[model samples]
Target: MKKKKEPLKYHIFQNITFLLKCIRREHPLLLIFIIMQVILSVISPVFGIYIPKITLDLVMGSADTAQIFLVLGGFGIVMVLSMALSGMANEGKYIMYNDMRRYYQMELFLQSLSCDYKNVESEEGQTKYQRAMSTLRNGDWSGTSIMIVSSIDIVVSLLCFFIYSGIMSSLSPYMVLLLIVLSLISLFGTRQAQSYEYKQNDLTAAYEKKLSYVIRTGSNAAFGKDMRLYHAGGWFQELRSSLIEESAKLAGKIQDRYFASGVVNAFVLFLRDGIAYSYLIYAVSAGQITIPEFTLYFGAVTAFSGFVNGIVNNLNELNGANLQMNSMRAFLDNTNDPEPETPLALSDLKEYSIEFCDVCFSYGTDTGFVLDHFNLKINAGEKIALVGVNGAGKTTVVKLLCGFYKPDSGIILIGGQDINNFRKKDLLKLYAAVFQDIYIPPFTAAENVSMQELKTTDRNRVEECLVKTGLWEQFCGQPTGIDTPMTKEITGGIVLSGGQQQKLLMARALYKDAPILILDEPTAALDPIAESRTYEQFHEIASDKTAVYISHRLASTRFCDKIAFLSNGKITEEGTHDELMQKGGAYSQMFALQSQYYQNKEVAAAYAEA
Candidate 1:
């Protein structure tokens, strides 16, 4: 089915109207202030047009001197009043602009955070989010302020144009018509220039993303050592310089074209002014107008030119803001996924037994299967260890179980009910996972480990989690303790080692206290003692929870009630650790080799300790 398109004028007008409505709703005083400014703006041009006529009358000695003095005084009074009102309005506009942008940016951030994780993982949704964020922070700062000012500029300009043009047209209608036509052409050119600049902004979004990645890799302390060790500095520098050059070139071209268009517009204005002046001279020679009339018409034409230029430039600015607003609106409008028919409340989660029947999955349809016809059953309170080599679909299983991705064809059941029918939020609350790669948020040590915002978290829970993970001493002995900021430049935050960070992450899982826990290589980087101690702690805390572990280290699986051995997306063996060793399959072979190596190392470590 074909869809209808909204007319551009209609959309622009609607946005402007909405902008005014929102501002009035948010800050009524500011609207009143701007309305007063607009009135002063309209009156200022009128005063400017009449003041010269009054001066010319006094000079030519053709009018009452007292009347001319009064006109001059009136002009000064209006000018003073307009300037005072305009100053106040400008201040209010600045405040309103900042407030409006801040309000909308916060609203968008909250909405993005609340959206489904599945949609966020989608390629299109990610791009849309990135575009909205970049535009909101960069070019959308003026917010509705630009639209309000532009609309007022256009109105005042049109009013002045008509009033002045009407008076001047009486002297020479042809000249007034010629000025009007030129004004329209200049406005058209400015709008085209604005659209070209908007496209340039859009084209730079991908470059912005690339640039951000380069910065993260090059400058971040965590990536700093890796970058140098791997000699990735040159590669990243090349990529960064390339994107910077491209962006500079594109921006330069856009500016040059816009400047050229402005020059063309100026050339047209020059010709129009020359023609109008020549007509004015002819009118004066024919004795058709007095000296005062000649000055009035001449002043009016100049005022009209200013009006035309002001309206065109304001319109272009408003058009650019509209472009940013449209991008944000499009992202917000489309990112919402279809709502579930019935929400599954978290109260419904009772048992953690999981069943997958005929499950088939792929990252994309074009990509080969990460899991094919995969089936597994984990009993309630079962500690299952998943053994697999790298890229053996180990992490995919954990992601699927956590409901981050759905199977292309499968029925994944929890407590004999299909997970597809489960409310996503409720399902998320049912499981806790510690992935291989952990995110260290720029927050306090407690907040980073607990994954809680400063405003939303309970201090007691934060303390308790830290204590459980053996990180409380380090956290509290610091200058600000849990209240400390996490960054080095920030006050009162002490940095912890990598193993300490991992323990803190484990504390977060413990805090979640869900029925199911998934730990993916939690001890991958830990020393032998810490690694074994971590599993022992997990066994103690997760005794009543369905614990799933993924690791290449076979020594870690000894505590599991059941083990699944995977190779190339397929599970080839599943049983108790003892049963798998007896089967002498892939699991048995890998286990024997690792156990032998580790056993000798442990013996030597014990001898050193003795």
Candidate 2:
């Protein structure tokens, strides 16, 4: 769905408030820039037009050389000072522009980082984030840094226009009148052109996302095997070309509209200039005005038109930039999932029992129920094995318990208090979750284990956990040891195999050492022998802590206190392996089928013995 852009009034207030806040930071430097602009604006016509006009009049008369030299020298001095002031302002503008842009860019990123986690997971939120990022990257820094400095230009331009227009009005009131009317016409045209360009940002961003993925996946070494084996390079190339062509077509249309408006505006100014010059020449020839008057009036005419155009153009550009800037503001202003204003804090974590009573849930942007009327409860220090085939809502229970999502109906309680009553940050202190999808950061092994920066990590604990989990044996012989980087994303870093990566993540979870632990297929990538070793280590480590284990290998569940067998989003059996085996339900049937291969091997051995 397309997002509706906010009104112009909203953008105007947002831009002014934002710029003022940024300006309040470095008023001294920005003030100097403004003063320079004012000085130059007042002096530009005096040197280039007014002083010269006075000297020319004296030269044309029956006058002495002393009078002429005096005026000429005044003009020369003003000329040098004006040029130097203009140079200073231009140099200052370039530096301040970059610094302010960087400031706002960082602010935008920080806002995104602190936004509601659940919102980040939603499709609409992701789309807004992408558009907001495009605004920052696209060089249209209106309503933020660029707008701050550009405001000074617009204000000064209007001030100069008024000063120059006053001079023109003295010569002829019609001169000022005609230019103002032309500026009005140009304003309408520019506004229309900018409106189209503003909407084009979204279209361009969408196409760019697709085009970038195609290029990245087609060329990345990670996808190299699939690209060649499937022979999908041609397909990627074709899709990339189509996206590029469509994006270019949309961009080309915007450029064409802008070019047309520019040409029309240029002609209008030329016509205005042509008429003023022609009218003044007639006056000079008819003796209604002198050569001196003609010279001053001609200069005034050109300067007059410039002021009009400058005011209109800056306003147009600022308004256009306002659209993109508002997008960035929208993303920042979006609050996270609604919750209590003042939340209750948790007590000492003696018992971390969890119960999900008649919970129902579906993803925010999706319609299908991942968990429907699901209910499960566990006492403190109970080792429950959650076993199910794929798509049986095993992992959903863990997600709800961790409060990653809230149930659409019913309640969850932790330590006999409603889970929702505790704040999100406080509630998360309860569990250490190791999921099927793991994020391996590019950092030293110690920092990855402790999940802290290098300085704050406890070396002794890091060493002990690594040793406990077999990761230390790999690192012990290296120069970096615990400091060794984990992923190849960093220089001097090494890549770990699938099993090593999984083990490293497991070590991180172990290091957290929270009261309750949830592990989903923690040994999925390990060999059977390695898997058995990890299972034994996990049980020993989690002996006292409440733990939930999920694995496709039913043989691993034999060690749990009780196995909760899930089928079609409900617990079909709750008992020990021996009890389930005797009952001969779905769990027993699946277990027997899985053991068939091992049983066949034993029969072959018996026949060979005979």
Candidate 3:
């Protein structure tokens, strides 16, 4: 379904209200500081225009020397005081802006972390996420800080416009009207330029996202070996160059529009100043107005033109800032399925039996179902192996069971209750999983195992899990023992082998000690014998927990109580290893082929060694 577009006024009001609430919550005094800065800024310039006129008029009139000195002294003192106050207010505003910018950035980060996992994985969702992140990262160009500053500019400019209009009217209302007309023409041109830039925002964001991806991938040490071995650096460079050239072309188009707007503004200013100055000079020479009055009116006319331009420019900037705010709000609002008003508590459940009934799921409307009418049941404390080839929906099944993705139809039940009944966070607490991909953060070994800070971690539990996973002796032999950092990027840190990293993940899962344990190809990095040994060790450690193991190595399924072979989005074969072999089906054939391949390889290695 298409979303209805919001009006410009609605976007402006809603974003402003949201930001004001943020300011109030984060720093209430910031608003006062901003207002103080604006008022002083406006007043200081007014004094600059009027004080000279007053001083000149006093000199030319019959005013005595003492009176002239008094006037000059008061003007100097007021100017100094205004400058000092403005400085203080500006300094305070700057500090507050930095604080608010950090607060807003953190809010965006938190929102990204908490949003639905499906959204994180989807293309449209990633685009929105990148756009929001890019908008916030460009602190001076767009986001909360720019929006707040642009809003203040509009208010200040409007205030100046009204004050200057009153001054200009004193000379002639016709002059004020002429200035307004010329300013409006310039404003129209500038607004056109701004609109063009606004329309290109999505394209610009796409380019930025691509450029960021290239830079990130190129710089990551993890990809360094692949790039070198495959000689792919030139390919990456060419891709980056192409993107940069295209982005530069787009930027050139935007700059051309701005340049045209500038030309129009310059022409309008030329006409306005020529007409105002010529009329004022004629009036003074004709003895209709005094020189002091001419000076005052001329100053007011020039300043009035500036005030008009300020209003136009600030309004354009405000609109741009509001557009970026809308992007961020859209991303933050893209939430997953709403939880029920009263979600079932995980603590109320005793047994952790899992069941999937007539379930169907697909990644998108255009994609075929990865799982269709898939039904499975695992009694409490039972161990099952789900064996399937790549893209056979084994991982999808695990993801659905873990509530990372919801099925399009049918139900997944846990302990006889619908999985949807539990809150996502609470549902996740019932299972501990180690998947194929591993990410070990640059933290101490103990922190990595426990997935907690040093202060809060149970040292004994972490040690116990490490020992069970066969990593305790290796860690203890290191200089820093379990306190050693896990990444080479950190000074005095050590990088683990792929096999060791897999073990670390296993330790993490064991530390959680949930009722259900899942290992999805988690031992892929280990040799076949080592992988089998690790699986056996994990089985012993999680003996009482309901276990689900997924692997293509059929030999490993021997230890499982039951083995279900998946094919074309359904379980096609199910039985113990001996039973499946005796049935002489697809599972039996695949297992025989794998066994023969491994045996031949072992013979070939032995012959080569001899």
Leading candidate by TM-score: 3
Task: List where candidate 2 sits over 4 angstroms from the true fold.
Answer: 1-9, 26-28, 60-64, 138-145, 171-174, 286-288, 348-350, 389-396, 489-491, 564-610
The clash number for model 2 is 0
Candidate 1 stretches greater than 4 Å from native: 1-10, 54-63, 118-130, 136-144, 168-176, 228-236, 357-361, 364-369, 406-411, 420-423, 453-468, 472-485, 566-572, 579-610
Q: Which candidate number would show the highest lDDT if scored against the true structure?
A: 3
**Candidate 3 residue-wise lDDT, 319-399, digit = tens:** 778878878887878878788689999887889888999999999999999998998888888889999888999999999
Candidate 1 lDDT over 1-610, as tens digits, reads 8434343333668788776777787778878877887788888778877877778768677658777778788779879988888888877677777777776677668777877666677775677677777655753245355666688788888888778878877877887778878877887887787777766665677777778878877898888888889999899899999999998998898888789888989888898788888888888888988888988888887887788777777778778777766766656665544546976555675777888787888988678999888888988899999988888898888878767777889888887667766777777888888889877666887677657777877778888877876778886767788877766777665666778778878888888888889899888877778787787788877989988898887767878899999876678899988799799899988876665564577763443232
- In model 1, the clashing pairs are none
lDDT of 2 by residue, 1-610 (tens): 9778545445655776676667568545865676787678667765577765787778888778987887788778888888888888877866676666677677778877777666677766776787777766745354455555556667777777777877878878876788788778878887888888877777777787778778988888768999899999899989999999999999999998898889888888788788888888988999988778888888877777776777788787678667766777778787766666778766644588777787887775457777667767778888888998898888888878878778888898776778888777777787877889866778898998999998888999999888877778888887888888987776667777778877887888888888888889888898766787887888877888888999877877778878988876667788888888889999888887776666577753432221
lDDT of each: 0.77, 0.77, 0.85
The estimated TM-scores of all candidates read 0.86, 0.89, 0.93
Residue 31 lDDT, candidate 2, scale 0-100: 58
Best to worst by lDDT, what's the order? 3, 1, 2
